[model samples]
Target: MRKLWPVILVLLIAVGLAVVLFPNGHKSLRAEKGPKPAQQSQSRAVAVEVAPAVTAVYQEDLRSVGSLMSDESVQIASEISGRIESFRFSEGQTVSAGDELVKLDDALARAELVDAQARFELARANLERARTLSKSGHVTERAQDEAKAAFETARAAVELANVRLAKHVIKAPFDGIVGLRNASVGAYVSIGTPIVNLEKIDVLKIDFKLPEAALTQIFPGQSVTVEVDAIPGRTFEAEIYAINPMVDVNGRALHVRARMANPDLILRPGLFARVTVKGRETRNVVMVPESAIVPRAGESVVYTIQGGKAVETKVTLGRRSAGMVQILSGLEPNTTVVVAGQLKLSNGSEVEIVQTQSPSALEKS
Candidate 1:
């Protein structure tokens, strides 16, 4: 038992010495055998095609798909409840402002006006008598004042009756083309009930969405070419009239409005149109090949060659034209970017520029 105790004591002393000398001995051994650093893992040079991100004149046109609208569109409706007595304008007929389009039963409105006129005449006579008597000190000033107020009230009633009678005859609010008729003769309709559609189509408007960034790039009066699908092979000219002040939060875009003239009465509202805005003024911009852009996690990234290594950079992309894309930000001009073999490359990866090429030259090829 004593011999065993000496062996156990010696083992315990050795174990205590090891713990005090190497507190992380196992960790050190594991570290020595662990995977290599990221750089060493990608030490082999990946063969890739390279292109210089050069400064280029960017004047690409802004194109959008949109719909045409009427310069003025309205759902023609009645202002008062009445039975439709007659339709003055035929279906699909052109109408001018103040032209009677529909007539309702105005018998009640005329009777009301006549009654109001009678009362108005009586009130005027009473006011005149009161004023004469007041001047002679026969009637009190209070009676004269009451008579004057009564006269004014009757006058207002007459005006009100005229307004009501006018409502019985519906007129065109503007020069426009009338759409299909909804009500027949003697069909009763209430206020705001749609009778037909009136559209000012001599001049047309267009509505489309554009990137919010375009707010500063575009302006009113910019010329654009519009191609309507219904009318093939014909390009109509249009002009930007306005831009919406508010931004669409969900789409992050701006609503743009434009106007187009239809002198021959050819172009119309409610037609699908493809609008191509004229190119902007020439300005220097950083451009790279589209192949350089790598999408990562819903973001655009590019590989810039620095010291023969791929340095991953996030870039804000802009207009793409002729196989090249504009780098709005996060990249500088004259920087070398990888155009090919990007799929096998990672950040800090060693690369060999197997072929140096220009994006524009390659696109032409």
Candidate 2:
């Protein structure tokens, strides 16, 4: 036991010496830890593509879908019910106002009118004779008064008969082009029944809607470019004449109407049209590539290089055309904006601008 105690004491001294010399275990066996993840990321730079903001002539225009309408449209119908006796205007014919379009059976109306005229003539003669007799004291004053009243009633009847006879023939209310016939000759038609369509298409109207946000960008008498798929590769110019004051709550849009000349008759109503409402042109508008914009939290943002770091910047956007967008605000001219590799960027992040475009190249004509 004594011999073992000496051996144990010597072992304790060696262990104490080792502890004093090396506090952390053997260096060869120890695991070496590298730099912290956050520290490493902070020291590393994110590679990104950038472009300098530039100025150019820019126009912000609104595009909307609409339908073309005739300047004046109505259905040719009879004012009185009768059988169609004849049609004075041919289908697809252009007629002037007051040109008779259709005729109906007016025999009964004419007979009644003739009867009314005869009665009116007789009453008038009796009235004259009654007054003459009253002056000579041959007829009583009451008899003369009755004859005068009868004469007035007969005259009214004649005028009413003439009006009825005139309604048997339907006339064009305005100068217009007539559509296909809805009723044939000898077909019975009632009042207000659609006989055919009449449209004043010498001038055409276009009806469309625009977002309520664009209310300030439009006005009456402004010109709009319209294109129809039916007539491809051609643009029809129109002038705005009306804008509805009320905004649609459900769609947040405004109704607008424009007029255009169709003297050539190249375009027709009911065609789907695309309307371009051009905004006022402005030179030297700040422009940037559309790819540089990043949408976040329902707002637009751009990553600009500031002090060799990516600074998340909020910006107001204007009209976008081609591959570019207008920077209405939030960025200075000639500022470098990240166009690519923005997905790896954050505010205050160190960035390496691998490729930067010159202002002239970015704003090239």
Candidate 3:
């Protein structure tokens, strides 16, 4: 019985060793009892939403600072040297053309005219007597000729005196508003002495400087829109009257002048204004938000969505304003562009556009 018990103990140890070494065979012997792994659910891809492109007409405008001036301005000066006897018009008063504005002393000039007239009468009488005597051989031919020459000289002197007297009254050259009077009544003024400043303000001339690149577009008779800081909410329409032929050597800019009507004279000379030169309207140009413009390798580019991925596109640009940039080439008007998430975008990265209320929300999707 003792030998039988030892054999049975060895047989049990061998069975335990076999079960530990081979578990699959042991599980089959143990009625197929085993722990099973839990099955994992299938994963889903993330949903990325993208906005479709929008089509809109982009308007471009140019802004520049300019100055307004009078259409006609003249610094009036004395024509003849004399004492100013009277001033016919007050300073700052509007005067018509040919209106007498100043009067110089003309008593001496008139007296000279009278003396020349008397000398002309005496010479004419002598020439007539000499001609009559020469016909009768009582006067020599040389004497008759001398008398005729004296009469002609006297007539010329009278005309010269009349012209000198006419210069005493200085008249307004044009209809304009006069500035400050430099010469007062009873003051002596010389020829070419500045009397007052005159300006025609029924219309004003606005002048501005533009870069040489605008030379081709700036021509005579082009329309311009003008805005003055002094009078807000008012816009004046003008036409390009002139353009400088020579470009400024120092600044490389061309000067332009435009005429603006100012019937109320509200637009004063020397007032600063904002000027816009209206070019021909361009149509069907591709545009995107100015913020989407990116500088790469000395060129401008923007990321546009294509085939569900962002693609970098190089574009030629033109006039830009109002938070919009005009794409001159390499882009279509309906091409979708990355507007907001450009910082995290790559060439082929997926983009999800966040839907939010925008100014153009009412537009078609």
lDDT of each: 0.90, 0.92, 0.80
Residue by residue across 1-365, what tens digits does model 3's lDDT show?
98799999999999999878987875586764543433211111112333333345654455578998998998888889999999989888999999998999999999999999999999999999999999999999999999999999999999999999999998998999999999788999999999899999999999898888888777899889998899999899999989989899999999898998999888889999999987655666666667677788899888877675678888887766666677778787566676666667777775555542243742421
Regions of model 1 farther than 4 Å from truth: 1-58, 281-365
* Per-residue lDDT of 286 in model 2: 88
Q: Candidate 1 has which clashing residue pairs, if any? A: none
Global lDDT for candidate 2? 0.92
Query: TM-scores of all models?
Result: 0.65, 0.77, 0.78
Give the better candidate number (1 or 3) by TM-score. Answer: 3
Better of 1 and 2 by lDDT: 2
> What clash count does candidate 3 reach?
0
In model 3, the clashing pairs are none
Candidate 2 colliding pairs, count? 0
Per-residue lDDT for 222-292 in model 2, tens only? 99999999988999999999999889899999999999999998889999999999986899888899889
Clashing pairs in 2: none
Worst 10 residues of 2 by lDDT: 26-35
Question: In candidate 1, how many Å is residue 103 off?
Answer: 0.7
Q: Between candidates 2 and 3, name the one with more favorable TM-score.
A: 3
